[model samples]
Target: MRRPQLLHLGGRPRQHAEREPRHRRFCRSSVALTVGLLLTGCAGGVEPGDAASPGPAALPEGVAVEIVQLRADVAVRQAQVHIVNGSDADLEIGDVAVDDPRFVAPATRVLPGRTSRVPAGGEVDIRVQLPDVACARDDVEPSEPTVALGFTVDGAAGTARVTADDPLGFLAPLHERECRAAALAEAATLAFTGFMPAPTGEPARLELTVTPTGGGSATLVAVQATNLLDFGPATVDGAFPLDVTVAPDDIAPIVVDIPILPSRCDPHAVQEDKRGTIFDVRLTLAGDPGEIELFVGDALRGDILTWVSSWCGFAGTP
Candidate 1:
């Protein structure tokens, strides 16, 4: 497994001494100054689409196109597309390109010639490679990873771009599963309460309950909680069964203590201060789709806001 140490927002590596190192101080100062100036330009937003250089024109009549699976890894991105012929006459489809310099559109060879006899369900796969200049980055990964694909149909043209928001976050689809959510909640509850709060930890405890929106069987995959801002050690319970089933309208509550410095801050602040760290859950359901609602003590608001499926990890069941 490859693990890259992430730098804090301050642009300095963590685990270093509180005092800045003399040699790296100059570099850090310069980066911070540059970021501050960039913030000023962001106050005024720019208008969309320029009259001098407009996007590709609309697609020709009788031709309809849809783009899907705009997927990418650390290296490349691919898209699966489906085109439909709505008119009586055959439509010719050609190459796609993004006109902007910030976007790269590799030459493509797939062409659906003018023919109406072919079924309306024909599909195509197109790949777009990022240019070195557009993909260049120093420390943190670039947020906008994908580019727009401009399509031409029967001589009419238009463009559409896909960015990071179009794809699920690294952990989004995982949290969607109920079984994973239960497992993750169970692990976080255990870790927060494992230490004795009197000496150095907090005095309060934690409890987690998950009520499935649908009646179905589910399984737990993995659970993870990062102590991003906190310096305390996190712990887990003994190995337990992975299958956690929930009947219709049933609620399951798993209690754990969250160590808090009551002397330092109020209860609301402690809860609000996840400290940039996140508690994760991975769950799966058998029959139908559902949501898992979370509660910390009497207040009920935090939730595992997404869904999950069986084919998530290395080992998956069809």
Candidate 2:
């Protein structure tokens, strides 16, 4: 009963000439009047070719980066660098790293043997391994996400300090989920105590016992649905948050029943299952709402998988 939790630019431009090409330049600008006029942006706010390399630019208002986790990435300790390029030009991305206060260390992008890029007015997702949580830090400010981005804008190389935009707002939730899970863990322990199969495609009740470690209080909100398993009569989307109070100072463990149903009929789902049997528990620890994902353990996982085969009439398909 435990839980856990982008840009590219185009071609190289001429340099060190009396007339520099019209483009964004981080380096010295050309002295020629035509070149200077053509150069759209230069570093240091000085004349072209007169100043130091351009400092990282502020990401345009429409351009944005955010941290997101797809279903596959949820338990893999990975996420995507979601980039939305609403600007007028394409961005050729180079080195990318995320600066998130909630994480103990910064996260870097994982390239798959090719240059990562975002087209103008388009979107891209770059995979990155997630970092450890820095949630225990009481001294730091709340989650403020930013990216140290190396990119090419208008054929000119530049770096940017971009404020991440979260349309789905996954960052703060990630922080809250981890911190609350940690707090609840310190206060109590949650584990799948038992499973009673009803057989013949009926709802099987899974038991979870909450043992108070005698520290804090929490409410077991509900269990969310997984791709292959569902809690019925599950949500319109399936598996909803169950309501229960796991108060502190309890001498004995409290057992709660989770009614589960098989949501998928495909045998391949179980054959290649990753998180199908795993469960996410929504809870409020000491009034701070968050979610904790618990694994069914190897033994129980096999049992659940087998039970699924039969329930879905998939008994030997695996």
TM-score of each: 0.27, 0.59
lDDT at residue 131 of model 1 (Cα atoms): 25
RMSD of each: 20.8, 10.9
Predicted candidate 2 versus true structure: per-residue lDDT over 63-116, tens digit per residue: 655555655566656676655555678777776677888888887765533345
Q: Which candidate comes out best when scored by TM-score?
A: 2
Model 2 whole-model lDDT (C-alpha atoms): 0.64
lDDT of 1 by residue, 1-318 (tens): 001112122111222133235224333333343343233222312125534545344332333333333212221222322233333433333344322222233323233221212122222233332222322223433332322334444344444332212222322232233334443343332222222313323332233333344444454433333322222243343111224544544455443334322222233333333322234433454543343322221111122100001111122211
